[model samples]
Target: MIQSTTPGKMDRLAAFIEVFKLRIAVVSTPHASSPGSPALLLAGSEDEGNARVVFRLHGFSEVPDDVRVVAEVNFDNEANPLMSALPDEISVPLGGSVALQATAMAFLSEAAEGRCGRSAALNRLAEVLMLMVLRSAIDSGAQQPGLLAGLAHASLHRALVSIHEMPAHPWTVDDLAASAAMSRSAFMSSFRTTVGMTPMAYLGAWRLTLARRHLKAGEAVKLTARRAGFGSAAAFSRAFSRAYGHAPADLKRAGASAL
Candidate 1:
């Protein structure tokens, strides 16, 4: 079920660079254990900075004490290099059972339309919030900033960018090495050292992530495989199963895939 690994896999992820166009949404609710329900406020929109941050407020009537989120969990590009280096979850407490929730998404039309589309205030707000969360996390000693700092290396960063920009291209160590202006040996060693995996292995992981998204969208297994750079769905399924512990069609059926 193994397909030949190539640089094309990274191209799929490159599309996410436009995340600034998304909007941030916030929802506030009271905790159940509180004696009195708290007031709630939710606000969001599509605009730079606005879309990157979301503000939610909750009020408690009787409780004099408050719970607070002293630290945040950030996941901005400037923060980390690992594509999926995120904590399982983060919690922020509001005094007196008040809660603030933040979420973000790009306008459907803008996202589907193309780049150069209008960026939403909500998107900017979301970005800001993300940055804040990560900063908070680092400040609170909840996570290691060193992990993210290390990912900012120039060669690895450029390699990541190249993969995201051209996922469909057939890529090799030689090609990537040329792109990074490094000898093949140096590139291979550096990439493995930084990412903790071989270049081909990273490519395979990227392809699988893309194929899973397409499958969940009900695009059909064969089409998903081809688009993700596999020659056939059978090959995709085999690779998917090996990597994720499930068949490609199973992802389609579950409908729990991420794009």
Candidate 2:
């Protein structure tokens, strides 16, 4: 479920998390992770190139290779707007921070517990830890302008969230500026500087992204177009082809062929 948006206290990561359809599995203690295992220690997933993301663990064996938390993270890196905002592979160092060590150990304890709702509990814990790592990345700011840089900005994030929450809406620069409580020109310039794209470009990209997801899921062309902010299926197909180099109907045909 998408978390209810709170005024002034919103969860910026909520939308992306929903797209991930996150799954978690904890490799409890006594199973020592390989010390040189970089792939298992990173908090990212592989791009499996399908609607479903393969189960990829957020490797937590960074320090001392204690325990690893397996997670099916966001694999649709191209479609996910904020994927570039994070480091491709992140492994937070717990050796330097006592608080971080406590946080990591707490989750391990929960993994060890044989209680009711253990799986859900462990998933939630891993989500929190992963969020901490992503939050650190967001807080550190970005050298290149993109979703991370825009999200790190004080005002731009609000506007970005507006676009994210309502992709189907016909968003104008004025509308988005009002959402951010900024002048149209200021919003435009700042957004370009921070996100490296015009607002409309971002909106179009977001719409096509949603459209691609629908197509990949085998949704009808007209319905997908309508739901993804296109005026008609033809328009959607044109834009989708320009972006992804294939027609929307092609995915359906592929799925049909497979079936």
Candidate 3:
């Protein structure tokens, strides 16, 4: 079934952003080239940064030469699915969109002013910039199979969003197909084609991703395992070690939070 292309289609994406915490800071301009170019650069790999966002602006010829805004952002989690699913570089030219241009100018002004709470304000602006870029990316779609490809699909996004919002819902192929409003075979075929993984496999990976987050925050193995729908700690540890090349305990930090 064809789904609406309107605004609410992406409503569930907000949950991912909520958990996908990132750090934004203003960094010095690395080099001077192509003034009048305002672009958003996303880090391609874990080495660079998972969800790192860099918005660099060399003021357009129309604006004063003094305005230059260069800021870098880093996402705290390496396992952010949104970043993992995207290509190495998604450049958004601010000049293309009137709304984006206005926002970029405001961001640049905020960064240059260094007023009270400048850091906080800049971070918020960076978020707006990131959101805009993400929307563009989702609309443009990806050539390869991944989350972006799946989300860009009208029917598939519903199931993907459901899976994302409730990773611990004990999802199955049939259930996921129902969520997507497709037959079991059709859903499996489309999901695998677009996401490059079977529905159950993606669910498992997503669960492990969340479990690792909790483990790194000092949550106990058994607690995380149970919450992740694992039968026992041993089973969970084996899967975790295979996926990350380290035991879950190795990720635990100094303090523990309520799991």
Per-residue lDDT value at 189 in model 3: 93
Global lDDT scores for all candidate models: 0.47, 0.65, 0.69
Task: Give the per-residue lDDT digits (tens) of candidate 2, residues 126-189.
Answer: 6566566666666666889898888778788877777777888888999999877899999999
- On residues 1-259, what C-alpha lDDT tens digit does candidate 3 reach at each position? 2334774474545656766775555545523324444434432232322323344333222322332554454444356877666565566655457776677767767866879998788778877887787777787779999888988898888887887777667778888898888999999999999989998888888889888878867888899998887778998899999998988888775345522
Q: Roughly what TM-score does model 3 have, to 2 decimal places?
A: 0.76
Tens digit per residue, CA lDDT, model 1, 154-220: 4554565566555556778888777667789998887777666776777777677666657766778
Ranking the candidates on TM-score from highest down gives 3, 2, 1
Comparing 2 and 3 on TM-score, the stronger one: 3
Provide the RMSD of all predictions against the true structure, rounded to 1 decimal. Answer: 12.1, 7.8, 8.1
Instruction: List where candidate 1 sits over 4 angstroms from the true fold.
Output: 1-14, 17-23, 29-83, 87-124, 129-151, 255-259
TM-score of each: 0.53, 0.74, 0.76
Runs of candidate 2 with Cα error greater than 4 angstroms are: 1-9, 27-78, 89-103, 112-120, 256-259
Clashing pairs in 2: 56-71, 57-70, 57-71
Candidate 2: count of backbone clashes, pairs at least 3 residues apart or interchain = 3
